[model samples]
Target: MSPFSLPSKPLHLALLGLLLFLLPFAILRERSYVTIDDNLDTEISIPYLLTRYHVALDYRPTAVVPPVMNGLPRNAMRSGLSVTVAVFALLEPLPAYLVHQALVRVLALLGMYALLRAHFLKRDNDKALAAGLALAWAVLPVYSMYGMSVLGQPWLLLAFLNLRQGRSRWTDWALIAGFPLWSFFVFVGPFVLVALAGLLLWDWQQGRGISKRVLLGMALLTILYLVVEYPLLYSLLIAKQFVPHRVEFDLGKLGPQTLAAQLKSAFLYFVTGHYHASRFFRGAAVLAVGAAFLLTPAAKRRAVLRQVLPLLVALAVVALFCGFAQQITDSLQRVIPPLRTFNLSRFHFLTPLLWFVVLVLSLRWLTSRKLQAAFIALQLLIGLGMNAEWLNNLRELAGRPLPDEPNYQAYVAPSLFADIQRYTMENAGPPALYRVACLGFPPSVAQLNSFYTLDSYQNNYPLAYKHEFRPLIAGELAKNAALRTYFDDWGNRCYLFSAELGRNFRVSARQHQQVQDWAFDAAAFQRLGGRYVLSAVQLQAPARSGLQLRGVFSARTAYWRVYLYEVVPSSSPKPGAAVGQKLPEISKFGLLVCKNG
Candidate 1:
């Protein structure tokens, strides 16, 4: 039976929804801050353009350089996802972010459904279980919060769905072609491409042809996407690729042990996220694969498994090899920086895919009672482990009281997250420009820490971190080295919201001195380890002309305030009035600029 043909199963849908709700609730209840890392930068840019300049998504944000500017790579102005949202925004002046996030969630659901229906169509019990598992995968609350901002995964899955159904139409073909364009934008493009290759090859083995029409459809989609997104993508690519490169190193020193450790870390991260969802499911899959392995005449099974598993194996090997060999990895990264773009830890998502293959084969083996029982037992054990891990992590996060030290317990000022959301909402009343000056060094807010900003969270809300803005504090920090410090120093104890009163929002000289002396020196930051890096910046200033004057921001932060200073002659700092204070009553989205400053 085709997956879509399955009768509507109300029970399965309910279970899926429940799983999603629980995941995010658990994450919110446990983790203090929303650690949305990499994509936040994109998020910030889109919203800022929408509000600051009347720049439609079709038009790049005026605050940024156009890709066409001075023969610059077009990607300098926007991102692939940005182009997608911008097009949507132009058609209707709606909040592209909320729409983007919703689209991702929906695509994730559709992808999960297609995957289950493809693999488990005949057995109602298995189908239901697989569907439930898919839902769990889609609604991982932590992933959802991250997804809340624009990212590449949604379209990635959407493209996969197109592949599964087979390109029956031109639109289907268009989307499939467009999938890889994001590969360069978000670092996950290579993995998705590999997955696409595996799927196509799997189909070919099942007696499908490599049709010209399909290839044409793919080509058409690429042209269409490029016409839309090329400007921004091109810019980003070139900027990071100039000769006499800013980052040059040898991968020769990266040894076998480093590769092994990276492999272990990747495996653990994947297991943790998919613990309950993948464990039992993966064990079942492995058994099915094993059965398929045993049943096929040795040679035939070897051929089929080789075709499917090789891609998975190759990707894993590369990730590990790069982790181990800096010279090779570095050389490759310089050529195709996608290798360096993502959190190598995120490569763990590959484990579940590998297990899925195993589970499919194992399910085929479940023809016998003994095999079934063994699979079931394995599933239960994995499920138990996942449940235990979730409980433990939650307990650890909750057990800690409000931090007495600044670094230990710095929550976002009240309504900050909400205010940003409100400001970004479509046609929400009042065009109040807000400039948030994050005081305490939260993982998501800190510029230097990799883990804190892995998925580009700050950018999602339209926050900008220029090259000059990042502290050379540590001279030259390797990406992995930076990531290690972020996790070690902050852990998951960062705050998204806090219960503290508004009056306490003032900055201290001691905090300022610490930020300047210790945090300012990137290399010296470790000595101030576990200490707060108090920094501040605002988004808007009082209008010199009208109530809604354009907003300008400087990169410099002093003491606890992000001083709203005007640029002066000769590179000398011109002091501007302090337009606003972070009073408790102020909305997170509302930056107060005193009328007569």
Candidate 2:
């Protein structure tokens, strides 16, 4: 048997290809530069914290993760029922991450292969094409922390299509039931349900009756989501524990303002896609799909349009909505209460699957095997080129590491934080005794090191806490307009903002950046139980800022030079205002009382 023969053992070939594609991430391990944007800085910490604190299954209304934002609600983190959370629970952070990534990619490969083989490309000779496309789809640079939300769409669609045709069995039902446990509802669920509804409507419009199985599948999927994401649903609907900062989310201020900018954003979203949902240059796919549609014979052109046009239109509509969402949301918020806080712009999540489906359809028209192979190769190249993980590995392999981008080991700096933690314990007390805030870096770093942080980067938290925390950064915000807008309009990242540093979080030791005119509120910092300020950069005029430098610490492999600054004591300190003293009863603002407080 030929080693590369598709018909004899297609699954083996696909698995081998996937293994090769993921080998760099596996081999590099902690040295690999994974995505840092919404990934390392935010999502990676959630699973780790959830498992570390043994709160993955904790459902108490007041359950909190003390390491984050003083005491962030446990529900505010990712769902405890998530497969990724379970993986984190079973293994260490890096190994668990690798295992989770491998699992997600394997699922993507199998799901796409099964979907294409069963529905899209069923001919005996089409196995190679299906396998190739499946492999390409699997290798797209998707955030694996999200599990199957983006990459699992093909499998999901396959299930739905089977139900619609009355060919679904136990396995299809299992897919529908199991999807919610692994995937996030807020990110992709609602949009997918809406798409399914649209599909049902289209079928009904075409004189086809409603498929009860499809309806059952939808209900099952929703029920599973509600069950898995019970904590999130409870926090939002039932408990209403706290008014989230999302309530004040000003889309108009946050997104593109003018028509031209909106159009440009829409065009970019259509062609390049969004970073959260598999971003890659789509010029090849777009051109091929367009050419195929145009070059089709008149007799079969209508049939082809029927297959491809809706997907094309859906992609355009999603892109335009994402671009103009701020305006649309602002106009609609007055009438639609849910639209005020809930982001309707996430409809673009559907575009990734839509674009790939269009690719599959377009490729079906090409009779020449060489032409199909060429287009597939071009797409694979584009996907890899855009993948940060892959590109960073290539750079590492070529001995060219980007100074700004640090690998997992350097970014996390476990040893450095361990040293700092030990020093803090010896000088002050246990980390649990006092809250610390971060400067020039995300609080997630401190949180990962088991530090109880006063500040954090959370998608949702109490609005009252936001107000309470604002005074600390008020001096800096007053000086900087952009910082003020970022906090006041969309205060997800309730960090100690500095006008001097702006929004650059990853300030390396090599930069030697210093806050010269430090406009920090030390009194407010003391009030919030902030015993120490862990800064990546030095505050040149520490006395002016009412801060006394305690120590300077660095690790050989760490990227940061942490300057530990203790809040200067007031001449007449208030009762319970001393360092390590318990904070006041501010936690009762929205039934979110901090356990440590």
Candidate 3:
């Protein structure tokens, strides 16, 4: 009869498991290998730059982070009003990241548990099942930088369901209002709102009158998102600042051209889900759902099919759209101008919550407690296996750290870059006086170390800046067709591209690759205020490229052998002389020409 018995015990154990799961990350700290794709390469730097520069709340159109892209607009980063930004501002990078991860997991666990207990599994025995499912959902290795956009869907659904039934309390309204502060608008808000709108229409079609409370809740959430994301709104709608590089986004050129490739992509999405939302292997969940449906009595099968078929169809539609997104957007943009850059494929973001919802519904049908427990255990293992942090920690624990996969210390190489920064300042003056570019590694590494960089991996930046920076990498792009498509078509990572390195940005000291036939435009680089190149690999024949090897710095714990190359003073082009004239013109890609040229 005690409050801490039965379901509460499982919930408590789940919390303990969550802590144990995160313990390695906390203990290892900077030595842990976190996900790098869209994470360490891009999102991690945004918070650090915003906080370090004291520009977290700066909303001026001109506000910029000088460390990246010679002044990446402040709006390009996540909104300063977010809880994620606050955490980063209050703590150091590594601690803030770990704390955010813990916060997200805890919130996810409690939110899913509360939702299931109140709505779906109110029975005494079902509470334990609910707790187990909540644990599996919580451990999903979604990008924490996205905050609750994926994991918080349960809370949103709970609040909306309460409102629709006209039994909502103050807590439901509070959830509707408070959710925006922790979640991203672009990532999940629009899709959530659209889904809510569809539900309202569906309710009306079913002869249920529209719920005024539900509409009000939706409105409150939308208004709060607009307020929280004010800077983004200002940039896109009001500021009318320089055109963003997204304006030149050519999805047709970027997406799969063949029908077979598109279908394959859709199938992968349907089964494996997207990486951003946590690619928790869905095989077990799918099997469980199929078994539950088949086990249903023949008389009740029609009703069950009616309930689940819509979700399955919706999942298929999202997958197909995402797979063929490039071609669809290319055609749709002709009629809808915003479709050119706006990612409609984010509908896939809803799949994680949907898959779990189906699993929960399927579990409800299975009467045997042992069968349900086995399914939950299998799902927990699958979720844990997909998590890179967990996998890396296991590898570290086993004493077989992947040489190519660098831990946080080695990946960021703070000590190595600190030495580079000190040597550069001691000789070339403060980093503020000159910009640097990365050759074989991500520019984010330089940005994280407080180096002023001429390059960055930004989702949004000025189109004019992209053109101005293209000349520096034009030769490399001309040599490699794939690199050309990546930059000219997608252009998210406006980095220093090299033909020898191709598109591989994570070249570590372990790789003995050298750029032998380096074709660099030092004059163009200098014109952009670039004075040094921090390469991971040695640039053979540096003198021929108008670069003087300043120093070869190395550290025992660092993953990169910092090859410092300074632009020779005489490499600055003479007035009126063409820079990178032998290389492809920016106009060849139907892009604006650099005004300086």
Candidate 4:
């Protein structure tokens, strides 16, 4: 059959295309809204990639990227969104997340259709069954919310579809390897390996030996990836070197309670109604499909089981993976703190999908053709209603509020970021030179500067950064620069090297960590390459020190009086002999000091 002929019916084809076209706008009625992670990663990664390719703003001058951070520029530093943004770089700025989700959903629906159609054709079953199963899975009431990147649900189904076809291509293998990079695959790869083995076993039983071409094709692709990324792979993996103070990894949502909750959540996540509201009746209906299979005759049961056994094995493998991932035992949770949520069930993406088509087939017991047609229509309606609910929920979430760091009424959007961005652009030298540092917070708001900053926040940090700034990581470096005090808050780590700060205004301790307050040793700040310090609080210059009072950005009218101070490099002192005097403990001023400054 020609690839175009897979839909088999004109109405099926039209609805599929129409749904794909509408999903982005429907689900993303949130406008250009973004989650903290989505806004942070996409804003940084898209520009980062485009800049490296010389297409967007340049970040190389002050990017401070570690070796691990540079693994694949075209990978665009996103999960599934990487493939989308790379393919359509032009769409990176506008609605990229929305567009990426739309594409993933489309692939999932179409892939389902193809996989089931192929199986049905071989067994001489009705192709409409394939269409109905594909439609049911497409709207199954679970998504990652941040972006489709974390939702491997669709991608897993698509991978199985590809496996069913048993065809090998270089591009296909390349994509399969990179599809879930850096996040879900970090811990989910083991179970997928088991599923792949199951596929191979089924094919062998069917008289098709392993395709050696796939083995060689994948081997060649592996060699190509390794050769292309030898420098990065060698530095990060072999030498254990990494970009210093850039990315960091902190254990998220740990402990037995978290694991237990996650297990319960995964089970509930599967049978949430079409509207994603609890419908235990529908869930029970799903289980009843299995009982129907049990009631089949000796001959029909055997034939169906042959096709379904592989899926069962695949499902079992993933179920075991999901269970292990939750660290079910108290001792295990102490060490592994699974990343998937009790609420979202993100890691169990493929579990529900594996045997869903079996249920769809079992529903075909209505003797009259009219009754069966009505049943199909009802399933499609349920899927659509669920999709409608999902869209409305997204709208509600977006309309509520963008989260402020803490519950300070000072708006996170339109104010905190807007004020910071305005002050930095007006003062931070030029686009190509100079970096801005937030004296208190770790550039969370400053990141919206959308270009370069001396601020950093990431989940994986290099060992070198830890070693060089041991005091900061250990939360020890106190005095003269309380910068270490600000490196962390709620387990997220943010670091930026002072060397990456800028070339001008030399100082001691090439970097400074965040501090308890904006007041760092003013004289020490100058030596540390801080040209402009945006203080969350107002401060008088370390009276009599080299610190000069610059314009106060967004003064008394705002929630806090944000003060901007210029670091005055001490004039080469006249032979008077007062080198670096203790410029009074301006506690009333900005009471603080910089690291070793």
Candidate 5:
């Protein structure tokens, strides 16, 4: 039946599903702050993005403009926030993270409303049901209590929403999809582009006429994307010096067993909330939906199977195309000529795009009341489990024993991050800038740097491959001297690329000093930009753990040249230098405590 004619039960299911999806975020609103990852995007990157092109600043030459948190690039992705920040800058530096989260929530709700209303909400009962479901989903307590990016997801959702509505040919789809992708190099840009191409190809293969209007629409897509990214794009091309090349991944040589393992990990990734804290419930809910589809009555099933088959085939195609570990590795290597600095991770936004389609199909399957109820029950169970999981996570954050990754503190925010940020910025004098490398650990802190790097974790996910960088990608990145400079290890101001370090940076005062001592000066620390002096004390050890040298003693510190190298060798013969001078060995003992005055 047409979406408009969906029965009461089916409509209820749609709304209920949406609410269920939203429930975690809504219920945990108080706890809702930007996760460290999101912060890296909106909070940290906003200032840098503004300064790069919009505002008059020294604009340090870096690998790319619109700097990123961690390894993720945030250069061209701040279009949505440019105006917001500009307004905030007028008042004061309002926390862009909060703004980002709020905006994302609104976008998510709107997208969900539009999706359900378009697909299921027909009569009064359906509307009520849809509202309930959407709310429940939106605020499900099972997801992380505080995080951002829900809004970002909806931009991609809108693109799919357009496609679902048979308006896939609309130029607006490309523009809408590209907007988010361009803004957050981590989420959906390249994936949306891939999805766009797929839709366009499908239409073309179906013999749909490519009208001048359509071609112009396509041109509009390009124009709009470039417009949004005009500033950053200009920097990369003119100032950054773009290069293009390819990088290779020997995935084919990874033997069948390793390949299978990677595939299983990827599959389990979506099937379970293995990595994502919010969508854990989605796994069981999707399974229940799958079961419901399988159990349909023969006649109804046959009718539905027509739709189901294409969807399943479509899913398989997308999954095969987007799935696998090496896909991302390759995507990062493939560069589009001048856009060498582009990241493949930006295509990850497509995961939500594909999932949106899957969710709609599941909701459509709820045309039957029994199935809808079963699915709802599954959702509720998942939600409950998710809540428990998060609570456990929080408890672990509070110094309780954790079952896994005992480093829960690594991902969670600490009180010190803000203080550290204040100190770093306030103290960093002219030409002395703060450059942080954000990995996906906190997922939110990477947006703080002048330029971010590619999160190695993202090297494994989907849509990650579509932008596969070849020599084309690398050569392009090489051309951008600014982008190259960001990667230079010239400063003491480097942030470790992980969530653990981010949270710890804020929580552990000593660690913060170790960081500062390694990178900045004591005077800079005291006067820290009129902000609090956030210092860390670091005790470095061989990254290779459990190695005990019988004769040699090792001292690990950022001041390697002075502390370790300058020390008189205690009757130890200096080893001959190879192609590279090897770091001196000092770890003879099992453990040693060395303190700095």
Candidate 6:
């Protein structure tokens, strides 16, 4: 065959087709690393192990790094981050995350295809139009903002599609069983159940039911799936540790108005792409198409009736589930209105999906093919532009350590591994493991270098850190100094939730002085393996930290300074002893110019 000739073999052609299809995303991935969303946590997992639970991989309530849940420090069976870490380990390395994202993109695209084909595109003039709209759905760039942490989405889509088409029995069981593994997708189960019920009604109206045996099998499978995943379900719903790791949420007062508002905002989140409302244009674009759709012929509407009915069915089912869940959730948590929960954006998937259905339907109705093509092209461009920052930052990170700055950027301290190993490791004492708490640099920097840091700002950390020490930091617990002392003593042993809370020996609270955002204690500075502190703020090293300033790394062009310190415990605290060091007792703090400004 000539070089220009297309491949004749089926496998080769398939490969060629896939290559061409994925090229744009590949370039985007190359220029950018995935950031934000659940990716922020999963990225830590790329280099994680149960053994170290290194400060970088801190996202659990256990006082111990790997989360000694229920007092089992040896049991490394926590979900969420652990699942992400295993995925990273299996996939191999840094860019492999991008691969999983790409796969999710493909899965989502195919899902859009299935949804389109069985509904809107069934009677369209051009069959290829379904794929084009599906492509639009795929390239929304929301993934960049959200990251592909919810591994169960594709499974959810598969389950919905299978039930919609009345696909094989085996597939339904697999999807049903698989979804509970990712809790975010489990929420879709109730939606799926409601949809399936509607599907049975429609089928019965057409003189066919979902088949009593198959329905029974599905019901059984759902129960078994829950049974299999009950431990995780219990943890997510009941355990405060897993609920509000990163963000704060409150149960709205139980009322129709609150439900209506949440329901409305939930839909709005889909258009705006959550976070910063990055995809507002996407929402607008969908609305414009919907508006133009109003002008179409009354007679031609029959073709779209096929599309609208199923779409509405899906929407109604999802909406009802969301409304019910919202009301029930508020009712359940009403007693503790101040209690926090995860982001409610978990229910926002249906809005974009409805948008997808309508956009495709509108495209089919348009008489001007140029207008149709233009509309899709415009959306594709806007979506890409909206998400350019994700790619741009990724590229910057990949090609950084620029000498003009000769400094770290964003949440990076790539060279800290060598810096700490050289400076702090060689001189440090036994228990060989030492933690390096960070001040100036991002929390991720400490993890990147494989250091233990109690100052971890990750989504998950020991609740005791937030509950006990946080109040002290905010002066909420200062009313009773004894309580602060108790918590200070508890902070070290707070990693595990068990009856033997005070039995474990740990260092007492050391004197802490917060100058700017920096907070640490001379005693904690020593006990939690505080050999070195990498901070951007320049300070007169207090003799109390036992943290002598070993070295300061920076370049003339650099805008920041990274100070490293060495620490040692001159003497040990008494077994199971407790002490609290208030800020007043510590030396006065003065801030210096650690930045170029």
Q: What would the per-residue lDDT of candidate 4 be over residues 378-482, giving only the tens digit for each residue? A: 555555565533444344445653223211113122254466556556865443333344443334444433434333444343433333323322322343233
Give the Å shift of residue 388 in candidate 2. Answer: 1.0
Q: Which residue ranges in model 3 land beyond 4 Å of their true spot?
A: 1-7, 572-597
- lDDT (Cα atoms) of all candidates against the true structure: 0.36, 0.84, 0.83, 0.40, 0.37, 0.44
lDDT of 1 at 524: 21
Off by more than 4 A, model 2:
1-8, 571-597
Error of 1 at 251 (Å): 8.2
TM-score of each: 0.53, 0.95, 0.94, 0.58, 0.55, 0.64
Model 5's lDDT to the true fold?
0.37
Candidate numbers sorted by TM-score from highest down: 2, 3, 6, 4, 5, 1
Task: Write the residue-wise lDDT of candidate 2 on 153-216 in tens digits.
Answer: 8878988999999876878888899899889898899999999999999999999989999999
In terms of TM-score, how similar is model 5 to the real structure? Answer: 0.55
Pairwise TM-score winner, candidates 1 and 5: 5
The Cα RMSD of model 6 versus the native structure comes to: 11.1
Ranking by lDDT: 2, 3, 6, 4, 5, 1
- Clash pairs detected, candidate 2: none
Alpha-carbon RMSD, candidate 3:
4.4
Question: What are the clashing pairs of model 3?
Answer: none
Best by lDDT: 2
Model 1 stretches with alpha carbons more than 4 Å out: 1-7, 14-33, 36-62, 65-106, 119-126, 140-142, 145-171, 174-184, 194-209, 234-322, 325-327, 333-351, 368-410, 415-597
| Candidate 6: residue pairs that collide | 33-394, 56-447, 62-495, 63-495
Please identify model 4 stretches exceeding 4 Å from their true place.
4-30, 35-82, 85-88, 120-129, 132-191, 201-232, 238-285, 294-317, 326-419, 425-428, 431-445, 454-459, 466-597
